[model samples]
Target: MKFIHIDKENSIAFYQQIMSSIEKAIKEKKLLRNDKLPSVNKICIEHKISRDTVLLAYEKLKKKGVVKSIRAKGYYVRTEDFNFDERYFLLFDELNIFKEDLLNSFLKGLAGKVQVDTFFHHFDPAMFSKLISDNMGNYSKYIILAANVEGVESSIARLPKNDVYIIDQMRNSLKIYSGIYQNFVENIYTAMESVLDLLQKYNRYILIFPGHKEPYDMVTGFEKFCREHGKNYSVIPDLKNFKLRKGQVFLIPNDRQLVETIEKCNHHHLVIGEDIGIISYNETPLKKVVQNGITTLSTDFSEMGKKLAQMVLKNERKLIENKCTLNLRKSL
Candidate 1:
């Protein structure tokens, strides 16, 4: 492998420059399929750059199906016939089963004309800022799941405003950007109202909301519902040290807490739906069978993903609220 000099004065990013160099080599028939690329350490030392810079470039190549990594051996050229219409930078907070559904829907809706590179920040504001800043001008589109993190507006503003689209939860500071988000406050309040009659059967409604992981607006919505309807409600951070009482309905967001709630109910020999009710946050295939179908208040993640793909395909700049539904199952 030839060592290309790292040009400090060039407008192009270091990783992108590396990517282009390799791509050019492949196109010119200089680098053939199954050719072993230089090791990350070799590239870093030769170019006087950090390991992460080389790794990022190589990772992008791998995502484009240009290279494949062999365990302990290093990366090898996978193919030279690389073709893609558009490249997308998808940034999510984390991946869950429901999120997997959303991602797959988005990919299917695009029909493989575009190549997507997905990354996760895990709700870290600093990491989110760094990822966005590092990949500033690489992709044609940037789809982000902003979650509820603060101090991200400035970082988001640094991107091409017209090319950015926010997904999942939307922050107020990022309102100017195109987004498909769940109206947490409204969704929860309205969902509760829809099941007002069933809720009246319970003695008290308890929302197990750990503010750090769960959205605060959900708390707001739950509070608003309880206040307007004059229902007895209490907000607890988690199910730690929680005791199950008969005729008490629980609203759980986290799956771990949901399991704990169900286990605790079983310990007390309390029957779900009749003795106590449960309303899970997001719906999944497992939720349909667990405890004989757990009721859920969930937004249409599939539709959200599809709409996001449409926005990217048509280059439409719009704010969309993906619809949410109350799935009343046996748990309710």
Candidate 2:
């Protein structure tokens, strides 16, 4: 087969470039069905590159079903239909941008090793159970970045012993395991304390949230901080009908409605959860929100990606739980 060079100094690896060229050739019928690939040594000698490079490229092409290696024979273009899913099981709050980044980081971390077959649909215990039931035997590895263990614990508990690692959230702290990050009540408390430290100066705080779980954690942390600091507070769920009198700070959860409400406020100051802050959770290249600026308590999602890479390489398959950092930004 003939090979062509597009851009030798391109950012992508030369082997990857070669692989792309050959795959494209196959698609275009340049390399007919069952065509034999250039021998690894020959390709290396012709390309003036290392044998490992050519072998690595061929291995990757084999994994994608673009080519296959035959026993006692060289690799050949796959003649049969190549069918496989390319998505992974990603579970997180749909409304949370940070959660999306965290999942992306985990998926990107696994780029070459295994393709993400499909993302597990929004946090549904039954859906995860169904996936495990249907594809457990088919899938060689399963990576889950569970934000809430209690939500889907029972469902995931039944899967076969495959490589499993929790990214942003943890199950419990008693056991030693590997993870990209950790989540706990302490971080929640820290987040609340952060907002309260600001609220104490103002006296009244407005709290907005999409649901009760995260808010509940923040409230526990905030109230605990307030009680220790000799301050009294009240929660006003009705923000529209409610009017801030004086010296009151508003702590809203990361929600679009709450975001719009904060935007409309003229002089009123706003604060989000101190723990599990929205800013701390954006772990992907995709930006979740375009805000003036927002403070958050988040974890290093790339580290989570690194940990995932380690787990997949080491074949680490255990339920891991981790948390995020209290990343502070200026959205408040």
Candidate 3:
């Protein structure tokens, strides 16, 4: 009946000690599913611990899906699996091939008692807020890929600032929070400059930016790169109205437009990487072979994931820029 133990001399926090004791009880078969845990008052009086400490531990277990609290009945063990060191709630704009890499890498990099629940907002601000509101206090950390979503600062402000992390695209409002983000403006500028030699054969540079979910900083970077190099350049909202010509290089952000660009090139009877060049944003394994290789400007998603794991594991409070790289291929 008396399963919980307290060690006040230990350096661990009181709440954490209470959680560890419960986990130890579960692991040793002393606690079973549906078994009622010691009451907060009983725990406090017997162990000389504060009521808040007992409640905090119970709440953490409840959030981890290990314990459930009933109205007037008190807390009971919800499951037999007691491995719950940390829980992370990861939010993304959308799940695509590249983002899949980021997610898988983050998951693979983490070891031990960790649970990651992933969700996507699909660029809907309402869905974004709803997800945050729903999972507000359920996780130890909140990792969000807050795309071009506007007015998220107010929503994120409700969360514990130290526990929230901004990923992918960072916003000015959430700059105070620690994050691992892509430097879109500088990455695009430098990546383009890196392929300047490949660009010399082309007469015009065009960026296919649909401008919906895509970051506007990309446009600024491309514009800056073109102006400094004195290269004739333009940004098109879509390929529906624009005509692709030979001796023109197109920088496409999304794969949909990239495919359209290639199709248009075929209609014009222009050869790729020769008569017309193509550069796409984000790198994937298929990109290496697609269109005889599509030149890509991208950040290392795998490394980003690994670094995020480290940040959480160490409880780091620094904003880190995930390394960006340009993968050169024949399409350019």
Candidate 4:
């Protein structure tokens, strides 16, 4: 009954205004399935607008499956699913500040073309399988962060193979599908190599790796780099009961341990960047401000998000490895 009085003074095209109003109404639930719309002729007369203008709007809506018309029954709401063209199921290993950056960048890149429902598997294989199995047909597409979980290959096999894309971690068993992934082995190796000069300043290099949650490839890479360079290095499970010594640089893979290392430095009265050095994995905003700055070996997560969005929209099937970078600062 209203095009909301088509304002000739406004810059928006009259037909588009009508389309927006209808779409807005559908989103707000003001119009639902089978709700009748004003007849084309009635809109033409009541709004003193051209029949062609009203027809253009209705035809567009019809094409999008938002509205339909019968030979004599006039137009009616076909569906109220106008908010998005598609729905996405996003599964992450866990929600962290860096992961939040990736999610935000992804949503921005998507530009509202689809609705996203995010979930976390927390690196639990059973939970990962259950979530995917339970939401088998709920979403149009599934983007998963496989983490280091086991049996993911079998779990994802039940899904529509073509509609799934792997995110973050990539495994040999799950290589059949497409995705954006991080090459942790090469990333860690190259990242440390990039800072070889800075590392030489310390007498020994140690990586604080707690077997759980961290990829084994990271240890492999760290060991490879250290061994090949003939540098003194050790990979220990954790910093528990560990001694803080001068001329030592700790390569911390997890944030919690990174904090613990820093606390150890404080407890032992060791001055970071002077008596002790630290290099942590993954970049966060606080890393730049904490301890003057924390040297980080990380992948460009925002770029990964943007590229993943493009991959989904374009249906690109290539295995993409996000670029990694080393942020050198006072912490190292």
- Say which candidate scores most in lDDT: 1
- Give per-candidate clash totals: 0, 37, 0, 0
After superposition, candidate 3 runs with Cα above 4 Å error: 1-51, 67-80
Q: Write the per-residue lDDT of candidate 3 for residues 40-132, one digit (tens) a residue.
A: 999899988788888989988877867878879998887887466667899999888778888888888786558888998999999999999
Model 1: per-residue lDDT, tens digit, 44-130?
Answer: 888889999999998778657787788789988888788984578999989988788899999998999998989999989999999
Q: lDDT for each of the candidates? A: 0.87, 0.55, 0.86, 0.85
Candidate 2 lDDT trough over 10 residues, lowest sum: 273-282
Better of 1 and 2 by lDDT: 1
How much lDDT does candidate 2 score? 0.55
Best of the candidates, TM-score: 3
Alpha-carbon lDDT of model 3: 0.86
- Arranged by TM-score with the best first, the candidates are 3, 1, 4, 2
Candidate 4 residue lDDT tens string, 41-123: 88888788999999988876764557767768888887777666667889999988778888999999999887788999998
Candidate 3: worst-modelled 10 consecutive residues by lDDT: 78-87
TM-score of 4: 0.74
| Candidate 3 colliding pairs | none
Summarize candidate 2's per-residue lDDT along 1-332 as a digit string, tens digits. 47534356789998888887887787677887788888888877777888888887877676465676776799788644444422234444343555555556666776655555545545555665665555443344555555442455555555443534445555454123444545445665666566654544455544554453342455555566556766655555545666645455545544454455544453454333321123222333322344435555556655666666667667765544445555445443
